[model samples]
Target chain A: MVTRSFPGRYDSLAQIGEFIRGITDKAGLNNFAAYTVEMAVDEACSNIIEHAYGAEDQGPITCTCKVNTKGLTIILEDRGRPFDPELVSEPDVTGELEDRPSHGLGLFFIRQWMDEVEFEFESGNGNRLTLYKKRTTASTKSTRQK
Target chain B: MEITHTQYKHCDLVKVKGRIDSYTAPQLAETFNKITDDGRFKIALEMSELDFMSSAGLRALINTQKVCKRYNRGELVLVAIPGNIHAALDLAGFIPLFKIFDDVLSAVGNF
Candidate 1:
């Protein structure tokens, strides 16, 4: 497992992307799979900076990447405002453009791209977002092709 | 993200390169705002070099599309979208919201 902490600010997003790409690439995830994981992590970190911390540079975002025989697991922890998923509905992706919203899609993408997503929050502790991605023989084969 | 504008006879082309996530989406949004403020509604976003985008980038596109489409003044079109960025547009159900083209000439001619 490799862990790193970054300041919860917009400027940290690029560094976060680099961190995820490096680990995902080293883990033998295919380009598409690695891209998906990178995008999901970006969405998760963006949400932490936007909603959880409630402001930029307000706290710290700790990210961990662990590789196992099964797949990869990523844990992101933040001490910002806790978010209740129940209150936020799936974004109306199929809705008319005029009726579309900007708020819910980040969380939606995080859930859609990752194989598993679990959110845990405590009042004094922090928000822990755990995401999983399964390794596949297809992914391995494709990586070898490159 | 870097955005460069090329003004056509009837349409304005905004070449967007680089990744637009939560951090750089505002730059794209600000670009659109500047275009609309200039009363140029017909705009084409060239995304040939775009490598990645998240929902924040989608938000910027939708917001600008809404503004350009208001009162049927004009519309925001997309040109030469990369494979990954195209998937993001498709996933967001934004494929049908704006007219998409494979090249810049066709997209600019659309205006």
Candidate 2:
């Protein structure tokens, strides 16, 4: 498992993305799988900064990723308000555009891309979100288009 | 993210390059507002060089599209979308929300 902590700021989003890219690269995930993981993590962390922490630079977000023969698991921890994305009900994704609610889309995408998503909260600490993506055709395939 | 504008006879073309996450989505929304504030409703977004876009970015586009499509005044169309973003749009069920095109000229001509 590789773990990294980031300042809960919007600017750190880019760095977080780079970090995930590196991890996915090292795991030899296919392009689509890597992109899925990247997008899921980005959405999760961004939601954390906006909702959990309620603002930028207000807390710390630690991300942990573990890749094994079967799948990849990611756990994100934030020392902020407990805004558990797992509690956000699934939105009406395929409904009419006018009928769709805007708030839950990020979480929806996260759920769609990941095989599993769960949340755990500590009493005096903070919120933890875990996501898993099963490897369908991976283990040694690089994401490169060569 | 960088936003550049080009005015056409029928619509305004907004070229966006770079990631559109929560941090930068507001800027994109503001850019659309500027166009609408100028009394232009029809807009074409050239996203050939776009690297990334999250749900926040989708929210910006959908909100603007709703405004432009209100009362049949105009609509927002997408042009030259990247593959990954196309997949994102597909997964979000956003493909049916706006008219997408292969190029800006076709999108501009649709107005």
For model 2, give the interface RMSD.
4.2
Q: How far in Å is the alpha carbon of B103 misplaced in model 1?
A: 1.1
- Model 2's DockQ score: 0.44
Runs of candidate 2 with Cα error greater than 4 angstroms are: A137-146
Top-lDDT candidate index: 2
List model 1 lDDT by residue over A1-146, tens digit each. Answer: 99999999987888899999899888888787787788889999998988898889899999999999888999999998887878889899898888999778878877776789999998897899999998884274332110
lDDT (Cα, 0-100) at A136 in candidate 2? 73
Cα deviation at B76, candidate 2, in Å, is: 0.3
- Who wins the DockQ comparison? 1
Q: Global lDDT of each model?
A: 0.86, 0.86
lDDT tens per residue, model 2, A21-123: 8988877777878888889999999989988899898989999999897888899999888785557788776887678677788888888888889988897
